[model samples]
Target chain A: NAGVTQTPKFRILKIGQSMTLQCTQDMNHNYMYWYRQDPGMGLKLIYYSVGAGITDKGEVPNGYNVSRSTTEDFPLRLELAAPSQTSVYFCASSSLAVYFTDTQYFGPGTRLTVL
Target chain B: GESVGLHLPTLSVQEGDNSIINCAYSNSASDYFIWYKQESGKGPQFIIDIRSNMDKRQGQRVTVLLNKTVKHLSLQIAATQPGDSAVYFCAEGPIDHGSSNTGKLIFGQGTTLQVKP
Candidate 1:
């Protein structure tokens, strides 16, 4: 099973341009998350979904939006790309029934550059 | 705001030696801690995790130790190899204050480990 997969492994966008980062998981996880990692730093959550039709903002969700219309797909939208949004974005999924610890599985990652 | 921080930004070790990476968290209420390893151009991968109830957990060639008294967590890699060279991050997750068990994770600044042969 391809635990999780992301589309457009790399992309470059101009300021004000908008695009969506696509993510899908075959594991049928109940939780999905979007995170961005800057150079030499750990990742920070942008948004997350508990299930389809339920989404919540995370630590740094100012410039990003997300939707989980189906259990298999959770896409992140960048409405007005800026230089601050240039970073490696990751998609992860996990099961909530694992009790206190939930091991999140991550996709390869999408590297975005905004100029 | 409460945050997690690493003790070192970079560490270099000779191949076949043991390596230890440390992290200090400000939140004493955090009940779950995790370790992730990321290669040069890849996403972070789960390495190991320990809950507040346990002090130590071992996996393959790695071990995680948690000291609640000082709110410290550490990852130990045994007989480190070239493939073990990567940036390691420690994450803390607190229990959901509400009815649900879902919660967000806070990641610490990564610590890069280099293995020299």
Candidate 2:
């Protein structure tokens, strides 16, 4: 299975440019998440969706937005990208079966560089 | 904000040795925990998990120990090898109710492990 897939393995953006990081999962998971990993810092949640059309903001939601138009896709949008937004972004999905104990499968990740 | 931070930033161990990475969490309400490994250019992959009810869980060559009373968690990798070199992260899930029933996870700053031959 492809588990989870993210497009544009690498990207670069100017200070004010905007772009969307596409994410998809063939696992048919109910929970999808977007997270960013900075240097020594671990993954920080950017946004998440419980199901199609249901999205919620996470710990580091500033300068970012997300949409879950379909079960197989949850794309993260960066607006007016700042150097602070330069980080490796990952997409994940889970069954949401037993609350927080479910295992999350991750995508390869997209490295974004903003100057 | 509630967060998880590692006790060490880096660790080096010889092959065939055991490695232990520790983490301290700020929130006691976190009942679920997970350990993830990330290679240089890859996303964090789930290794194992332990819940508050259980103090320990073992998988393949890794074991996770949780001390809820102290808000401490550790991941032990046995017979460490060069293939095990990567950044390890521990994550805690908040056990909140209402609109946050989803129980999102909070990740710690990772510990980089380097294994030598």
Show pairs that collide, candidate 1. Answer: none
Off by over 4 Å in 2: A98-100, B95-99
Total backbone clashes of candidate 2, pairs 3 or more residues apart or in separate chains: 0
Q: TM-score: which candidate is best? A: 1
Q: Model 2, range B2-117, lDDT digits (tens) per residue? A: 87999999999999999999999989888889999999888889899998889999999999999878889999999999999999999888655554566578889899999999
| C-alpha local distance difference test of each model | 0.92, 0.90
- Estimated TM-score for each candidate: 0.97, 0.95
TM-score of 2: 0.95
Cand. 1: chain B TM-score: 0.96
Give the 10-residue window scoring lowest on summed lDDT in candidate 2 chain A.
A95-104
lDDT of 1 by residue, B1-117 (tens): 889999999999999999999999999989899999999888889999998999999999999999999999999999999999999999999856544666578899899999999
Kindly provide the TM-score obtained by chain B of candidate 2 when compared with the true chain B: 0.94
Q: To one decimal place, how large is model 1's interface RMSD in Å?
A: 2.3
Q: What is the lDDT of residue B84 in candidate 1?
A: 100
lDDT by residue (tens digit), candidate 2, A1-115: 8889999999999999999999999999988999998877888888988899999998899999999989999999999999999999999998865444477889999999999
lDDT of 2 at B81: 90
